[model samples]
Target: MTDDTMGRFGLSRRTLLRGGLGGAAALALGAPAVRAAPREVKISMQRSSVLFTVLKVKGTLAERLAPLGFTPTWHLFTSVIEPMNAGAVDIHADVADAVPIFTQSAKAPLTFYARERGAPSAEAIIVPADSPIRTVADLRGRTVGVSRGSGSHYVLAAALKRSGLTLADIKPAYLQAPEGAVAFDQGALDAWSIWDPFLAFAEAKRPVRVIADGNGLTSYHRYYVVNDGFVAAHPEVVATVYRALVEAGAWMKANPEEAVALLAPIWGDLPPAVVAAANSRRSYAVEPVERSQLGEQQAIADVFYEAKLIPRRIDATDVKIFQPPTGRG
Candidate 1:
């Protein structure tokens, strides 16, 4: 047939050969193969995610997902769980471990797909350098800034308990990152419980002392969560996204300079050195979530419940776990 006639068939010679081989193989197996329709996956992003930020900037995730008939639609959120729980996003990037605990307490249906190993030192409670507060106990009766359900909140609680105090012992100014930074800079809050790169930014620009970090208190794992319904309906898409995250994390760790270069401008033009310092505190090793490793999550949930931060107690490990493809870490 002529080129125009062949073009009307909408099949190239190579494509025909591949299709025939596939058809013969399927017939040999006595089953028809199937392919899913193209799908759109809404992924959540935040400035805190150095890994996803780099991946998003590079646009490599889209290229990686294209082969699987999935398109990525990224939505930026200051906090991920609320929007993800509201059905605003399908895939949630890594968020502090404590975030999911609160979501679970609220009965949000989310599945844990992957986790970044604990980088305990990534968050801390900071006081002015010359402040009289020299220890965790000093925080009692002091006005402290903290994001209510953030990882730093749990760290603050654990730190205080170690020093014979509780959330009630202090006057907590429940503030988001921006508000917390402003309050801290203006000396309205005695101390701020926060995580990087905010932690890194504040330290670089201000005179502060870190009274405590998550080191001995919590692992501070960052988790990737997916809406439960989406998890069941589009497992393949979830797996692809998981693998892409794993690869992106690995790439960032391997190329520190490039990673910082990509992150600096995005982090409000923060100095590269500051960004590097913040990144160094995080463990970019993404792995599948296991029930046994959830001890810290359970502790966070119990602590929050006891502190009356969450309305109800939750079994942290009761949520669904999405297994990555076999042979993945």
Candidate 2:
């Protein structure tokens, strides 16, 4: 009953455990308590991540997680999925729907935590004003520039499919936004598939014609993903991060001018007008990822596989979806 009595009986908790009882049994008999170690939350964000930038600027997530014994570390990435798959990132700010499909195809353990509502006009296939390309059909046999495995890549695929064509119909130039912009500008590419704020930047800098956007093709939903291990280890941290993201999105939408002013310097010093235009096309409403709404994700996966873009086909809904805590802690 007491430490003195147990010692007098030569039956201390450790002695009992050594006499063949287990740790749990010994704990039930009043063993010393164990403490969990503090965790480091590695959050990854792309340069174009407006809401995440807002969070970083305000240090909102860090403040929220500090009380939970978590130290938040932010990492900027150009290609986020690779770092996420390599376990270098604990939480990804957000990426296009096609990004997850590609990561899943590679067998990376990922969990969808939150999703931005679909913004159909956020990305498009554009061509120079003087170009002969008029519709998606005209893109056939032309050199099209797009980032490999990116959201705009899916837009290109869906747009081509709608016109009874595929990636093979065009000579694909796999390039990042800057490279694609250069190629498109130098009269090298027949068409370029891109997303905002790069899309807005390109349109403002030059005279271009939009052949197609995500309107009837892809939803262009951005998703916040987390490492499976992180989700299992610190669910509370995940919930906190998700709530912070939702709040940041709401703030960005509510205060457009302030959002632009805050983002302009961080966004390569792009003009406020360009930032506003880009922000206008995006729906920053963050919500849970519903299983029923993953139809487009499945479609993106199937299309990529059909076009031999991914190594193998993946079940879009096979990954985990995190639900935030309902009540107070």
Candidate 3:
């Protein structure tokens, strides 16, 4: 038959040899499958801070991945967003708000693989116990200090909105957490917007009151995200790492006292009481991203967009890399 006739009849020279109909049979008969080896991953973590919960997975992850032939390297980043944006780190452990901000501003192709479940109420706006800032409404016309672009900034914005105030209503002083804490203590700033364990530390010394926390104001769910490319290329490794973190989180919850002792040596000789207080508020479950969680994150993004904190609008759900929840011991 002519070439045109063969094409019309759904029979071609190439198709005949490949045996489209019998391909599975041929493969099942003698073809050998090729499997690729696992890739090494370099996980980036915050050097020191309450963000150091990443350390909980250090050795456990290595042991977990032994069978998969995956090796994990731990590195420290001073700021989670910068390293994540620059592609200097494959994974980031920080507040969920960071994901939306970076995704909107830096256009980083990052995706959330998992989040700490049970919504730990860790971040908040703190006023000295003697300070008159009892409610969010009281902050109007006063100076409020927050780390620009961090989760604290988002919390501050939400707190203001809840109290019928806007950023313009208050004088915002941009400073790092440490500097802000010092300034707050020294009476340079009226209030400090911060996250734990710094928040816990500040409360321990002198007296500080949590004017508002992440409970109703923010999702504040800590997340473990990797670059989209990295996640797509090494899903198995990502799954393995997440599994280890979930286990570590559970361990911390079960043994808060022991967890504090384990973290003390690395966290600059913090008082046991301070560490215990911080640990009490932290949840360590690696809950998979759910629609409600994404909705809350989207709300954060929308608020930031309306406030012009980010130049453009973004869809929070577009950046998530969802994986089925895996049980861990």
Candidate 4:
């Protein structure tokens, strides 16, 4: 990792916190100090999300929240958008930075708290080793399997734009990462747009070649989103988890091999080298979301809108950012 990236966040940085429950208000006003809600919370992620998967396997979130009295229930989902909108989890651990734009357009009551900056090289478009596709231009009339509303989706869009083609130029196969892998291997699709861990696995186990990756075309930032209710109910706990994630991110960077080993068991016994290859491309530098960082999200939204993938134009930053909640003494 570069010194600049490492310096973006460190374990030494404390949350900019100042918030409290009505208990504090009650104390100040001399009324009954109403107890806060139960400390239990739910977190959700799909295996496709690398950081959340690592966090789940390491058991760090549970460990971090223990002192805070949180009862964290792990919820597995096919994708985050559904569970997030359905309120199945308080924390939607990591979803593609582009996804929330579509969700926001749908008016889901979710918000962004943390975001891992772009590691565009981590996401790519792969073709079978022997395929005749020589360039992004060659993909013009081919079928490409991709996860809908994913960073990989944005990667494919950005890559295509550089080739002077659009989504309409190719037969887009909207499949989840796993399904895309199967399709690519079985030749059900002409090419697969995927992210690492899965991308690394495909390159290792399947005869594939990266025809194009997201470098120079996109910023593959992933977001740690939360249910709006969770923020209102337990802002302190949210801040704590955010801190825990930053620490975990640092740990991942400092010890990549160990991170790979830790993730092997949870990722359906993925080979450590494949996991490591995947890990190599990621930043894993978790940071608080800022309005400035969100500039690319607007471009992502525009990409999806032009593709007609999203129903309408939406401000990518319309959802609230979880500030270090400020409160009365």
Q: Report lDDT per candidate.
A: 0.86, 0.87, 0.73, 0.79
What's the distance in Å from true for residue 129, model 1?
A: 0.9
TM-score (C-alpha) between model 2 and the true structure: 0.86
Tens digit of lDDT per residue, candidate 3, span 193-275?
Answer: 88877787788777888888887877677776788888887777777776766667777788778888877767668889888
Off by over 4 Å in 1: 1-38, 327-329
In candidate 2, clashing pairs total 0
TM-score of each candidate structure, all chains considered together: 0.87, 0.86, 0.80, 0.84
Q: Candidate 4: lDDT over CA atoms?
A: 0.79
Candidate that beats the other on lDDT, 1 or 4, i.e. the better one: 1
Candidate 4 lDDT over 1-329, as tens digits, reads: 34454367541111211234345544654555554654768888777666666666778777777777786777787666677667777888587777787688778888788888778888889998899997888998899999888888888988898889999999999988778878887889988988877788788877788888887867788888888987888887888778877777899999888887888887778877788888888898888888767878888899889888888988776669986533311
Give lDDT tens digits, candidate 1, residues 22-46. Answer: 6755555455667687678888887
> Can you tell me which runs of candidate 2 are displaced by over 4 Å?
1-39, 327-329
- Local distance difference test, candidate 1: 0.86
Q: Candidate 4: where are CA atoms >4 Å away?
A: 1-39, 325-329
